[model samples]
Target: MRALYQIAFLACILFSCGCSDSNPSPSDDDNVPPPSGTSSFDIITQELSNDLTIDIYVPRVENASGKYPIIYFNDGDVFKGAIASLTSYKFEASSGIEPFIMVGISAAGHRYGRYIPYNDQWIKENWSDYSPGSINYTQRLINEVIPKVEEDYPVDTKRRAIFGFSLSGLYAAWAGINYPEVFSFSASMSPSFWVADYAIFDEPRELSNTRFYFDIGTKEWNYYVPMIESLENLGFRYGKDIFYYEVPGGIHAESDWASRLHIPLGLFLNGTPEEVEGYEIIKECIPSQSTAGLVFQRLNPIVTFTNGIRYSLSTSASFQVVSGDGVVLEDGRFDTKGGSMTVEVSHGNWSEHISLNNCNN
Candidate 1:
């Protein structure tokens, strides 16, 4: 059932009613013409006998000439297709986003080793398969890739940004946190925060001018909420320097991430938050539907704004047992007594009621 739903969602993303008329399909082949007003090329970097392919995309702004900001992407080969397509669409539509150079750094064959942090214990345990080269990879990117690009192109070095998803998303966050001087912005899409029991949080972080954008799908497990809270604890404000988005009905697939890529791109390039006129609250019981004999674990209230940005109000929202014998635990979970129960959840000016029935049919 879930698989079928995901297929349908992907179809909506790929072939939405007006998408064909508005944005043409992007080509995956390098030999094909690149996005309009954008020049594309590739570079090879050899490190430790591994050849890394880096794809570069530079958007040409006619009648306006100045140094453009640059965004570096991990998992170059996989994301370049979507990046190229979106670049073309934005250009054709006159999206008003500032021009920027894109650098897509391919992980090549050392993805697992290069994406994970060097101090991660998982890589140490699986030393044979994933060589100890994460630190080296980071160094190469900072010292090698950035230098090569800056030397060849007219770029705004101060406004550099890093972007990645999943494990590579973790890398993007790590780089931004550790080297804010190098990357002023970082966009992490569904990062693997559970890696090495969340050891990334243990690393020391200093307050800086760096901005971060984080997001996860509602259909996916809530592994990134804690990371967002951690950033808040470090003095990062929502919709300001740090942004967290809960994508409604989104999944862990690349197609899902590709569809909403414009959100981060607009935020970083234009430096404006989408205006919110209204919002809808989506209540989801952790298990959705559970066996009658099972206990209710958790209830998640996701607030999705009219701007299409969603947020999980689980930690900050107030949860109260409205009517039922069920008890609201101190940890915010409801204890069902094999009967129907209703809970009222409130956040800011919004309130919603969620009813659960554990009674056997």
Candidate 2:
């Protein structure tokens, strides 16, 4: 998502102009090659005034089956190399990242008209064709583009996500806020959050159900990081529900976005074996009469416990250690579930009984 200079020079947009086929070489010892995948040629879309071109990447597997998540790229034309590289690295058998299909929507010149909201006075001053009450850009994405992608691919619309850089980064945030049902996850790299005079902050909504990622270069605009921090202040769960990073020497450039794309992608698409196993254990633990008879070990800073089974409590926890007969053993905060035979936890006004297997079932 590069900023537009003017309508006449749209062809010469600064970032995300081309696609790459090369795989990024990972230096980490843990890196391994993923299954081979094919990159589809440009697909035309009739949704917007400017016919948008979408490039799709599908991973090739021996038994390629099941529905995979879909990620929409805002400035899709560029970052093809980075996308391919990360897909390979993360989807490697050991990486634990679930396989997904990527749909890249090229930013063929309407970067300003489409990505930036008309509410921003600064943007309106720069671009004459700005529409004040129109979402023609997002409309085409939802009404037209996604349906077209789904026509030819098996995509899990329930787990949809979007990513963009700079102005398109701003669009990512806007889409997530406005259409949570469509885009439940978003990554905004060096987002032009300053648009519309920080209109995003004019009573910004909490993304309780969304998984968001934000990152900016340490040396970019001075106010950018603070604005991001303000967004975080709206009560997003840091590691669980949201992720924010300040790249040490990162800049507002495609190279920076390419270099760090995997960080957000992995967080959204992949999980560590521990995390995956923990998710299963928690899912199983939720069923009635489920039990894991083992000594418990607790992991802190995020309110989690593990034995042969693991459970991570939400941030809004009010844990109670209760006896088998329903007597309260301890009534404390989220960290009160340790060394207990039975514990009742409350989160966001909902409660559940977690049976700790301190005794034989």
Candidate 3:
């Protein structure tokens, strides 16, 4: 999928230092032309003696600029290439929706060790046998890689963020809390909160300037609910700047994360990215209309309710919606989703397919 990001609530990023007359800055996520003179670069830092490596994607907009805003994705290299794939990268890069220097660190070998917070208790419990080079790996990211990126490239140190999925998501949050000076914004996708029960929020230091984005699927697990709720209940607002999304059925993997990437980049980096303006729930699948073949060609399958509100029933065949009239309906929603303009429906012993290609709202 092709995607771009926006620069929302960027009071912190403006100070990152890339906007200088001597050196211009990169374009915003919109892919607008750089304001002339912006330059970017990539650099590898092996100075920390930690056997660490990093791949930096500079915006090329930070020319001669002292510092450019940064967005670092932990295990980004892994999340991009094979595990998650980089078409997402090509999409963002080419589309210019939300553009910034993307730095991807190779966590190919030691993901578990570096992503998890390592303390005495954690070491003994979740990481019964600690991953040998994990903490050091994170240290490499924090101390070795970041500083080198700053030194080697013309980037604004102040305007920066870290993000990733699963363990990497966990690490991105940890880095923001541990070294707020280095990164001011953070996002975590489907984090593994149970790793040590609120250990993340209980970091040793509090970053007065840090803004965060945390998301989890409603059906993921019990831990996510409490973890996110606790953060909200506590005085941890991070205020209007913090972005939170509760995906109804998000899972734990790159595919799941990829599908939802737009949320974080929209809400956090760009503030409610979807164009909900001219858009409304065009089709609230009547729960009664649900059936076995309840899917429209490419749209998200949904089961409409009597009130006209539609919701996804189940992608698999194990579930269906029962209408008030006692009619078992296949659940799903429809829209100008694909070229087919058709919906499949099915229910116990009954089946019907409907054509919604004419739906236009």
Q: Which number leads on lDDT?
A: 1
Winner on lDDT (1 vs 3)? 1
* Regions of candidate 2 where Cα sits further than 4 Å from its true position: 1-50, 62-65, 78-90, 126-129, 132-134, 224-235, 271-361
Where model 1 places Cα greater than 4 Å from the true spot, the runs are: 1-50, 62-65, 91-94, 118-128, 218-222, 272-274, 285-321, 325-347, 351-361
Task: Report the lDDT tens digits of candidate 1 across residue range 91-149.
Answer: 43355655678888876646666777855554344333454456677788877888888
Which pairs clash (backbone N, Cα, C closer than 3 Å) in model 2? 120-196
Better of 2 and 3 by TM-score: 2
lDDT of 2 by residue, 2-97 (tens): 121111112122222221112111112113332376432223334334558877766554214478787898866544444545554334565455
lDDT, candidate 3, at 200:
67
The residue ranges of model 3 lying beyond 4 angstroms of the native Cα positions read: 1-50, 60-67, 82-98, 119-128, 131-138, 204-207, 228-235, 271-361
Per-model C-alpha lDDT, please?
0.62, 0.54, 0.47
State the lDDT at 221 in candidate 2: 34
